[model samples]
Target: MSNLSKLEFVALDISGKNFLPWTLDAQIHLTAKNLGETIIDDNETSLQDKAKAMIFLRHHLHEDLKREYLTIKDPLELWNNIQDRFDHQKLVLLLKARSEWIHLRLQDYKSVSEYNSALFRISSELKLCGDNITDEDMLEKTFSTFHPSNLILAQQYRERKFTKYSELISCLLVAEENNKLLLQNHQARPVGTNPLPETNAISTRSKHGRGRSGGPHRGRGRGRGRSNTWHRESHNTKIDGGRGSSRQNTGRPHKGRVSGDKDNICYRCGMSNHWSRTCRTPKHLVEAYQRTMKEKGKQTETNLIEGAPNSSSPAFWSDTHLEACDFIENVRDV
Candidate 1:
């Protein structure tokens, strides 16, 4: 009934990706629905079902994405068409991600956390491409990601050969914290100014390093060691027809992380899972969100609504039948 999976929507929205398993699962789920099973049949009803699936796919896709397969009418053919494209497309993406990983120089970023997060993001992309980087490789990457100024300290780390990444990170964090304290103590600016203008400058530098060369070294450990993953399961389990267990994968995982909860996240709203983008949210739920936000008084419903169509939501359709399937992706700046 829906177009893309939660993971696929997030992938497309966040990284402009389409994890194969997620998309395949969505198509499979759709075809398993009413009339979907008869897509291969030759009867009028079967043809109707296939057409319905085709409509579903067309309806769910962001406006721009539909153009590629616009002429294809068969549901399975459309699915195959998309899959064929992605087969080549994902490989290119994988290459690009790997290139980023290989060329990532620590001197590029300013903060350790920022640098580490970027590195981990690359790591995640590598995983998506079936490249399982080892723990040692990760550690080596971490060690390799220091600014030239920290070379001596990094050299010392090589000599020390610390057993735990966390332990090493802790030391680095302590050192960073101490450095900040010293910087504050020796602040040239007045008290009214920022205590650590130097740190702020570093942060700015780190953020701007995108598509640039040298990456920044982490002076401190702001996050835990990257051993744990993004998945967290519900403690509450229900028995379904004497089946083993029933659970909901509620929380959204980060880009690099993977937890199979296709039904959870909505690709449209870019928020919580368990809802479809095409379906309007329940009134009660909308009211609840409104109440919560009204108390906070920040963003509102207007922010989420699609604005007037621009050049991006181009009119590809000449026929009236395709109108219901038309989708606008709600263009936004990257």
Candidate 2:
């Protein structure tokens, strides 16, 4: 009974659904047996029950609407009066919704997906307002709204029959993805790619294989160990065929030096007569060398801080260190 008292009337239309005064009236009549509405006709008690139901229906209405219903004592008349006023409001709301649908555009949204979603939302609103929209009509409207550049594709799609709206949307998404991929491929070369002349790969592979095996093919060291190894060639092709010229050699190998003996090669500058440590032509080499030294210093400092052999510095195995340094130099060359 207390819950029933809390059921206030609220006048709101749900398109085709039930609304306020209707809900209040139905609740009262359904629960009337408990409220004593079944007792007598035109009697004081019966009138009181009907009055109670009408008051609940009228309680939450705005002042102007309430005043209009005040002259009607019966619940049914009050309901009819409220409907007459709200029906007019519904027409005004429908007009506003239709105006929004007319002004909506694909350009207002950031992407194809967002534009499509907004178009559907406006179409749905218009439908609720009594516009009889069909999927085929929606498909044509959506295609017409695309940007002028995209409209060409929309027209191409029109040439086909039996294409659903969903299929068109899927096609648009696929085309968008393909365009992005093509743009990406155009902007940057992929990794591990040597797009330079095919000869560079052959020359590099030959040098690499010989360096790894330290074999006779490379003059069998010719008494020229790691120190007197073959020098860099004239062409310093980039690993990825990128822009910018290769690092210049500081000077030509002293006129008649054997090409197999690159003992004094400056791997960083592709120059001979000076080692990488001595070469100062390439600025990047200086930075990398400094960075390597700093990292070594930091490692020594970390060991001391952690209380590991604080008395004396750690010793490096010469052979292993040399091999590791060679590997690093090879990577920098690439």
What is the TM-score of each predicted model, taking all chains together?
Answer: 0.40, 0.38
Residue runs of model 1 more than 4 Å from their true location after superposition:
1-56, 64-76, 159-171, 188-334
Q: Write the per-residue lDDT of candidate 1 for residues 217-332, one digit (tens) a residue.
A: 33335442222222223344222323222344345432343545655765433346445534355445556766765687575565566555444444423322453225545444
- Which is the leading candidate under TM-score? 1
The TM-score of predicted model 2 comes to: 0.38
Please write out the lDDT profile of model 2 over residues 82-160, one tens digit for every residue. Answer: 5665555545656876787777765566767876787677676566557876768767766667677767776787777
**lDDT of residue 215 for candidate 2:** 49
After superposition, the stretches of candidate 2 with alpha carbons farther than 4 Å from their true spots are 1-75, 160-334
Cα misplacement distance, residue 142 of candidate 2 (Å): 0.6
Error of 1 at 321 (Å): 99
lDDT of 2: 0.56
